[model samples]
Target chain A: MSAITLFGILDVLGTFVFGLSGAMVAIRRQLDIFGILVLAAATGVAGGIVRDLLLGDTPPAVFSTLRPLSAVCAAAVCAFFFGALIDRLKRPVMLFDAIGLGVFAVAGCEKALAHGLAAPGAILLGVITAIGGGMLRDMMATEVPRVLREEVYALAALAGAAIYVIALRLGLTETIAASAGVLLAVALRIASVRFGWQLPRAPGS
Target chain B: MSAITLFGILDVLGTFVFGLSGAMVAIRRQLDIFGILVLAAATGVAGGIVRDLLLGDTPPAVFSTLRPLSAVCAAAVCAFFFGALIDRLKRPVMLFDAIGLGVFAVAGCEKALAHGLAAPGAILLGVITAIGGGMLRDMMATEVPRVLREEVYALAALAGAAIYVIALRLGLTETIAASAGVLLAVALRIASVRFGWQLPRAPGS
Candidate 1:
């Protein structure tokens, strides 16, 4: 598949996972339908919006197209129809969130590289875009972001971005680089969660 | 004074007020000093950051100068010193907020116009820049924005933007037009608050 098509698939998958996580949070908060939709929209598109804005693109994806709109619609539908099933999942919501983080990290890095950003800038954008939507969602929920509090979230994205850049330098094809990056991120995140790996805080105690 | 200088003064004044409001909210939430500073910085400069991004300006204000940093510092000092006093005088907070809204509305419109935006786009930017900081604050606080719910807030900014555009079209000087716009916005906002004026809800409310 073309790089563009691969990017599109990853983007939509990331949006759906992010939207579902946001909806789950909204459900836990007992927000109304409007609130749920708002949270879903914000979570699904906030990272891309920030990425676009920082890249000097205008109007943001949330305002520019129907993809984000459809993502929100799908989130709302899932929340309304499969609410019970979703709530009963054995693994915590963090599994889906990890998938989102992996996909978005790869997608964001790819987009930044396509836009001619240097490797460092692309990596920073990758990490930011992977976690930005969840950060916004947590801010809106008045909760600390998971990346800030729990999980090796941002670190995973950073590692994946680094791998992607290195692969590009080694003359790897786009699909191979992207697959490697996404899998690396997902594996690192899931392994971190399973093994309780976390960043060390300042030693105060 | 030159028109640009006058607008610059207004911009600083608005930043001060926005920072004050953010610090107050942080104090109310019982956040630590670091949290207070974070909120202050976010509230004082996020609107301008978003505006600059939308206008395709590189290295947004947050990265460009120390003025925004100074504004946050000033706010932190004020909040630390006068937290109790501010907590008691809620009316003064509202009045200061009105003034800030007026200044931001005029400044936003003028900036958008300078960027060669059309009247509608300028007006929209005016409203967004005037209230966007507060929206971010409310989102961080996990509350619906007061501008979205309370008396004639965004509407007042819109009115001021429209008046500014009209004055410009009528060949008025920039200073006169901006001053008139600010006054119009402040008066309308204060009047709305005093008389309990509000917009009609969307249909089906």
Candidate 2:
């Protein structure tokens, strides 16, 4: 597949899953329709936008183009109607989000690399892009960002991106490197949840 | 004075005030050194970065240049050391923040217009840029944004931007237009604070 095709698929899937996550938060907060849509869109594209900005890509594709924007809107609508059912299957929903997170992490890394960013900057951008949407969603909803609070959220993304960067340097093909990144991120996230892994909080209460 | 000169000065001054505000919030939350620095930098530059991205300006000046970054760092350091004294002088600080808000609002609008954005797009970007830093700061600190609360905060910025756009369209000098925008925003903010002005929150809320 062409690079655009590969990244596009991952981007859409990530946007949809993130949109669902954001919509779920809005539902829990009893927000109005406008708030729900805003949160959903914010979660879907804010990360990519930030990454694009950092990489000096002007007019982020997510904002100027229509495909990703449409995907986010569609996801928001789906979540709005089926939130109750989705909420009931929390475990499966989380698994989907984990996969989506990995997809986003790898995609962000690859995009940064393609844009000529150095390894370290690309790795940092990958993690930032993976977490930016959810952070924006929580902020808009007046809550703490889940990534900063607990668990190995950003760390998992970071590891995945780092794996991708190393794989690239080691002569792996684009598809293989991307796949490895995705798999690693997803596995780490699932394991963290299953094993109750968490980073220690501040020293005292 | 020239438009660029006026905006450059106001931007630097606004960055300082916002850095102070972000640092104050960080101190109140009792975050670590890293968190304080991040919050300060985010508040100082996040707004302009968002605006530049939306306008398709690559490599935002705040990140590419040293002056603004230095200003943010200085603000963070000052707030870290004298937070108690600054906290005690709440009234004066409030007045300073209000003026900073006006300065940022006008600068954002003018910058957007200078970049060839049409009136509507310019207005929206202006509002986003005016509020972007504060929203990011609050999100980083895990709190609801002050602009979304019970006050005439964002409205003041919006009104100011709108005034600037209108004044420019009416054949006014850039200096005069910018000045008018600043005056209106400051007056509205101060009046809102002094006279208990507030936007109606939801119909029954």
Winner by TM-score: 1
The digit string of per-residue lDDT tens for model 1 on B52-82 reads 7767765776787887778777987799789
lDDT of 2 at A191: 94
lDDT of 1 at B179: 86
Name the top DockQ candidate: 2
What local lDDT does model 2 show for residue B53?
72
Clashing residue pairs found in predicted model 1: none
TM-score of each candidate's B chain against the true B chain: 0.93, 0.94
True contacts kept of 2: 0.26
What CAPRI-style quality would you assign to candidate 1? incorrect
Interface RMSD, every prediction, one decimal place = 6.9, 5.4
Prediction RMSDs, each to the true structure: 6.9, 6.8
Residues B30-110 of candidate 2 have per-residue lDDT tens digits of: 887778888988998899888877777767778678877887888888888899998898887777777778888887777
